[model samples]
Target: MLIFWKPRLALLAVPKTGTTALENALASSADAAIVNPPGLKHCTVRKYRRDLSGFFEQKGKRPLSLVAVMREPVDWLGSWYRYRGRDALAGQENSTAGMTFDAFVQAYLQDNPPACAKVGSQAAFLEGGVDHLFRYDRPSDLIDFLRDRLGQPVEVGRANVSPDGDLTLSRQTRAALETGRGADFELWSAL
Candidate 1:
């Protein structure tokens, strides 16, 4: 997460959305940047409203507008599967090594997904609401907005990207994912 005090805007770092690149580009201009410990780096809007909003908005006397980037739901899941399957995570319990995309997705739709499919939902992360949202597939929308909001040109390069891989899923599994995680699709579509 990043806060631009002058703009009274906060950027929530949504996972699998190139947030790291955006943060790297915008950090210098931000009044503060939370970049360590995955829990804090990827703090949800709900957590912010419950824990930190008061400190920044009430005590600071500024009501900050929140912003985030959301990816197409299926693509987001694909990224998660690919990321966990990387060689670095080969022996880890959360690794997706030797797993088919369909199997990974099936586990993800479970009420209690296995570690490999435990990536949290984008919809749940932003359930508290946000003032602005941009689509991961639409880079210019975010870049242009940041340029204006930060008063400078903004550039983002790929960071923490997963290696190319097949993300194929059977039709039945696809249907299950769409049904199980509908909110993610809805939220991304809104962007």
Candidate 2:
């Protein structure tokens, strides 16, 4: 017989999804400890318990569950691109800096592509078996859900700044995310 020791509830931080804001809120409201990811000096732990079966494992002494907060793909992608593109273009002049949004989107999808290896894919989230997912677009919803789950009133506030530029994905990437990597999002959009 195997026994599973549920640790505390694990919060899987997805990048650029108002995670920092939510982390601050949860940290203040619930007295939870936020674990920064390894290597990256300033980032949340996006991956949790790989052996636990993607998003399925929680490590604590009780039956623990998982929770995540994500944003609409369009906004999330745009913010991500600005943050990253600025960094990439820091030292280069006329280095595709003036490219059209469409061209940038094309390059983005082709080069980075949408993968769980970087950003948290919806497929990964669905397969991770998280107990509940809160949309960052609506913080109140997350707060209410967290209150019920954690047995405390968590104040979810707007802490992170919105993205600086338009972050719409190129047509190809949009189509793929809508149909492939983000099929779950598509379904949610339908409902």
Candidate 3:
């Protein structure tokens, strides 16, 4: 997450949405940057509103506007699947090493997903607290918004990309995900 005090803006780091690259690019100019301890780095909108919003308003005399990015729900799940399948996580309980993308996504749609498919929903992360939302597939739009707000160009390169592979979900699995994660699909569609 990156905060620009002058702009009274906070960029919430939605996972797998190229936030790392944005954080890296804006760190020098940001009034503050939270980039360690995954919990803090990926603080959700609810947490920020509950914990930091009051502090910012008290100290800065105004509330910070929040910005976040959302990826297409299925692609987001695919990234999680591919990420956990990396060699580094092989044999770990959280590893998706031998699992097919369809299996991984089916696990994700479970009421209680296993570690490998427990990736949180973007809609849940940004629920009710975003002043601006960007589509993950549209980098230029985000960059342009940042430039306008910060009075400087904002550049972000890809970071933390999941391993490359073709990920095809079975029709049944896709239908289940769409039904089970309706909020995610709705939010992404609205974006």
Best by lDDT: 1
Residue 52 error, candidate 3, Å: 1.0
The residue pairs found clashing in candidate 1 are none
Quote the positional error of residue 92 for candidate 3 in Å. 1.0
Steric clash pairs (candidate 2): 6-60, 6-61, 6-62, 7-59, 7-60, 7-61, 78-167
Please rank every candidate by lDDT, starting with the best. Answer: 1, 3, 2
Runs in model 1 deviating more than 4 A are: none
TM-score, candidate number 3: 0.96
Provide the RMSD of all predictions against the true structure, rounded to 1 decimal.
Answer: 1.0, 6.3, 1.2
Report the lDDT tens digits of candidate 3 across residue range 62-121. 878999999999888888888899999999989999899998998888889899888989
Model 3 C-alpha lDDT versus the unseen true structure: 0.89
Error of 1 at 33 (Å): 0.6
What TM-score goes with each of the models?
0.97, 0.65, 0.96
Off by over 4 Å in 3: none
lDDT of each: 0.89, 0.51, 0.89
Better of 2 and 3 by lDDT: 3
